[model samples]
Target chain A: MQQNDYTYAVARIRFKETKLLSDADLDALLSAKDTDAVMRLLHDKGWGDGTSHTSDELFSMEEEKLWSFVSECIDDLSVLDFLRVPNDYHNLKVAIKCITRDIEPNGLFLSDSVSDAEAVYEAIKNRDYNALPEYLRDAAKEAMTTLLQTSDGQLCDIIVDKACMEHVYRLGKESENDIIRLYCELFVASADIKIAVRCAKTKKKIGFIRRAMASCDSLDIDKLSSAAAEGYDAILSYLASTDYRSAIDAINTSMSAFEKWCDDDMTAVLKPQKWEPFGIGPIVAYIIARQNEIKAVRMILAGKVSDISENTIKERLRSMYV
Target chain B: MSEILNNSGLFLALLGAAFATFMAGIGSAIGVGKAGVAAAGVLSEQPDLFGKVLIFQLLPATQGIYGLLVGFLILSNVGLLGGVEEVSLLKGSLYFAASLPIAFAGFYSAIHQSKCSVAGIGTVVKKPDQMGKALILPAMVETYAILALLISILAVNGINGIQV
Candidate 1:
């Protein structure tokens, strides 16, 4: 019923996207001598200015700073922002887990909307699920119940991830703005495809895969179900017959390659819709571009730190805008 | 005699042509405005891609060209050229018919097409190499306007109002 205010948002987004990681940034991140060297580069780029920590502290600090910067850009709450949902889900999951484990609530939880962080911590500390916010109440409870029943940490992790994916997928379909819809669909589809590949390759049972795989707007779910049941090979064949055939071979060989394939496919589909002038297309596109840049940087840095072959790392790199 | 056809009706036909062209031009202008902003944004980020994004931004202007072409075709058929100068009712109607499509179609289509280009700018932001795809979506939206132009041009050519 409401129209999107893309003009203001896209203008701001364009400026932000310009400041994102470039090819040089990726190269620098990949060649860094240590975590300190990477942190210094981030500081130069106006990221994590106040942090002088390392290990988990450094990662969490930079992550929080990034989330806060993005959260600040959002002016309207009714717009159904997709950028924040992943962090929200992650934070909620962390809170619930910390509670169940009876551990000190770490700073891994990050959110702007949730004011009562301590209440969440206390709820987790005391095993009191009733004290959390209403918005996250149902999802947290559902995930917690499942976790209690399954007791498999991986299953719990997948359930939380699926919930986040569902949030993104549903938001895409409900949105009237075509660009936003495209972005939401693309993101969900990538997540879906990645899960499908993992589920198939690991030879996980259909029940586990069913709980793990969330529906995306672009994927034909019926086709995916049949393929998933038939295992990884069947899923790859099914994908080959569709628009994402470019990803099928990669899915068969390496999980990392499959992950990169999803990213590339999303970029390919979204790149085609960039010329539209009004609504949320530009904003969504800019966000997606930024997400890809961050992922590329993280991948390159990880590859370098772990001493992976440069050729292998280069093969894993996604496309960067001019 | 043909005196009535020779004067006032010719003016009316000319007026219709101008009006159609003017309206359609407005749509193209707005679309160009939006696409120009997007192009400028992309150019600033990836200066090397100015040429590619530049072409994408210009694609939506085709709607305006369609309108202008329709207008000119109508004028030529009204014997504003080197032909007989008598304008009949049928000739006036033909000019009006020619103006109608480009007038309405160009204007409306231009707005929609420009909007698509604005969205296309985002595509440019992430992957400048895909600028062609981005522009094509809007170009698809402007296809009907091109069809309108063709219809009007053919209709205007069929009019025999003036042999001046």
Candidate 2:
């Protein structure tokens, strides 16, 4: 498709981009006295309204606003299915677990998912696999069955997570847009690396490790699984020879640090798209930036409310796209 | 046929006028349409930028007017806009040639200029303070279009003085 097709959409995205949080803004939030203080700061910056609200409420509001804005800008949002597909899988996991546990799935399911979380929950609740979207239908059945049979929540998560990663990877490969493909590549690959690191730490065998990790182009699943079997260091050594070599130090520090590096590096890599006037790239970048901004603010609020150290909070903050 | 060739001068001159009007008009339409979409996007969010984006959207429009102006010049020179007069084959050919610079330059320049205008609109969206700079970039595209207009005008007027 012609890149200019998104000219109008991208132009609106450009204006929307100005509302995203910058590094300096994040720093200011870092200095805020407490969670309420941070929310006040965000309110002042046009994050939420001036009305009294909790951070979670404000975060949900902002996510809704983002989806509304993006929906207004583009005609077809299916191009973003790769981004939302993970939410579908997460909701599926929540539903299966909640149903099996005979508990309410309140406040746990994500908003703005492809399929309605409540609908997904109901479908799973009634054991009507046909009601779910085709992409989630098979995975939902398998995960629910696995949880019922094995009574292993982790195994259920494994089944659902694996399906999620494979679906994201397949979508990325099928996409014609470079930004979508690249985002999916890093997303699945990073998940694989994290799984490898976790498996290596937990001393899980190669079979379970392979079962957990999805195949992506950037990471060699076989080599990574084999290296993961050895230990965390071996996994690190294996990554050092791959594209993720630069993240070795962050991995050495901690998985949380590695997660931060992944987010920060992706923003840094996609930052140039902010200046682009036309294409799906800028729109995707804006979405990523907004989501990251929300994540950073949530972390700050969580840390502040719990009285976590400032330096520790700063360590976890993802880089701003601005 | 010899009959058509003998009367081809008037036909050719008319064709030249049509070229200037339609070719550049098409380009301007495309340029203005593209810029207008971007401008609308900005206005939907920040309606205060209407004046600033309006200027950017109108920048590509000048080429269409220039095209119309050249078309009029060609029509008047060949007497189509006034009294019917016989124009030699050579003079008709010269008029056709003169229309080319604007016809093509206006066509391509409007498109390229609109690209610059679209980028400028994006810049203005982020930094409304840089409106002056943003306007200047696309206006530079006008220089070439003006140059083409200059040549076409001078050439058409000069062709009027020829005895052929």
Instruction: Evaluate model 1: give its TM-score.
Output: 0.60
Flag regions of model 2 displaced more than 4 Å: A1-4, B88-90
DockQ of each: 0.12, 0.82
**TM-score winner:** 2
Cα displacement (Å) at residue A10, model 2: 2.4
Measured by lDDT, the strongest candidate is: 2
Report the C-alpha displacement of residue B157, candidate 2, in angstroms. 2.3
**Cα deviation of A14, candidate 2, in Å:** 2.4
User: lDDT by residue for model 2 over A176-278, one digit each (tens)?
Assistant: 8888898999999999999999999999999999999999888999999999999988998999899999999999999999999999888987999988888
| lDDT, candidate 1, B1-164, per-residue tens | 67765566787788778878888999888778776766765554467767766666676788777777777766776667668466766557667766888889888888777777767766676666676676678779877987888787776776643443
For model 2, give the TM-score of chain B: 0.97
Error of 2 at A71 (Å): 0.7
Score each candidate by Cα lDDT: 0.69, 0.90
Best by DockQ: 2
Q: Calculate the i-RMS of every candidate, to one decimal place.
A: 4.3, 0.5
